[model samples]
Target: MKNAFVFLATGFEEIETLGTVDLLRRGGIHVTMVSIMDTCEVIGTHNISVNADSLFKDVDFSLADALIIPGGIPGSNHLNDYVPLKELILQKEKEGVILAAICAGPMVLGGLGLLNGKKATCFPFFEPTMTGATPTGNGVEQDGNIITCKGPGFVFDFGLLIVRNLRGEETVNEVAAAVLAPGY
Candidate 1:
């Protein structure tokens, strides 16, 4: 149960949404995609209809070892609109669970003031949105258990980094060699 939970909303960036989950699961994490809606269905900004593993209410997110939010205009906005998603994000942080956000996703955490003084990195647009972040220019930044990545370009690195941290370097190397060596 290394992963425990992974949240995906409508309008999510296809790359960020899928890449991270795939990579982590390759490293043997138990990732679950929670939809923002009742039905386990979400349409990405690209109009890609991705079926989720469960409804947002169906999952006891508090049991998760980590909470992930992918970035995309509709995806992030969709997550913002869902009170349960926001609540889970806040509660995960309050309980000190590992919270990972990428691109605009960090803004969601910032809005809740979970990122004050933390070294965080997100898309250029989210810079202004982050009120109290250190604003690291690095492609990825991990502040304690909360890890943040830039965008889709860094999706592979973000996913691998988290897996390396959670599952150790050996599993990370094996997964990278097996899954990332060839183009997906």
Candidate 2:
């Protein structure tokens, strides 16, 4: 099975994180929720608390096929500021692993220069932060190994896209049908 790590820092967007996890798991990916904070329980921006499957330092990411970042206020900033996470992201990029982010989460990629010369999309206000990237302002945009989405409204599309990238269109179709998602 393909393995994926979803980072859960404090103040993460509940819908984007959990929705993606749900979809990926349904598509047969082994999804691991990783907490970057010192504790396993991380609170979302809306005050929802979720216990991560593992701490950031406790998991081996060598098998990861994808690294997912969900966007929310201070959560995105925390992810961008975490040195270890940033380093891992860079390493993953060098290995050609898929890097996916939603909303402000793409800011982390933007700040790391990973978006350079790539077409990406993020929450409108963060367009400037995506240095060297062409902001498409679409609900979902995929440029090679990187996948980005606009915001909460597009979480399902974002998740389905990631599933497609990691698995295949057939798996995406199955998952989408199971979920009864429109326009699959």
Which candidate comes out best when scored by lDDT?
2
- Candidate 2, residues 1-184: lDDT per residue as tens digits? 9999999999999999999999999999999999999999999999999999999999999999999999998899899999999999999999999999999999999999999999999999988888889999999999999999999899889999999998999999999999998788
RMSD of 2: 0.6
State TM-scores per candidate.
Answer: 0.92, 0.98
For residues 7-110, what per-residue lDDT tens digits would candidate 1 score against the true structure?
77778898898888898899899899888766788887799988889887777664677788899987887776778777877777778778888888888888
Name every residue pair that clashes in candidate 1.
Answer: 11-75
Which regions of candidate 2 are displaced past 4 Å? none
* Each model's backbone clash number: 1, 0
Task: Please report, in order, the local distance difference test score of every candidate based on alpha carbons.
Answer: 0.82, 0.95
Provide the lDDT at 64 for model 1: 79
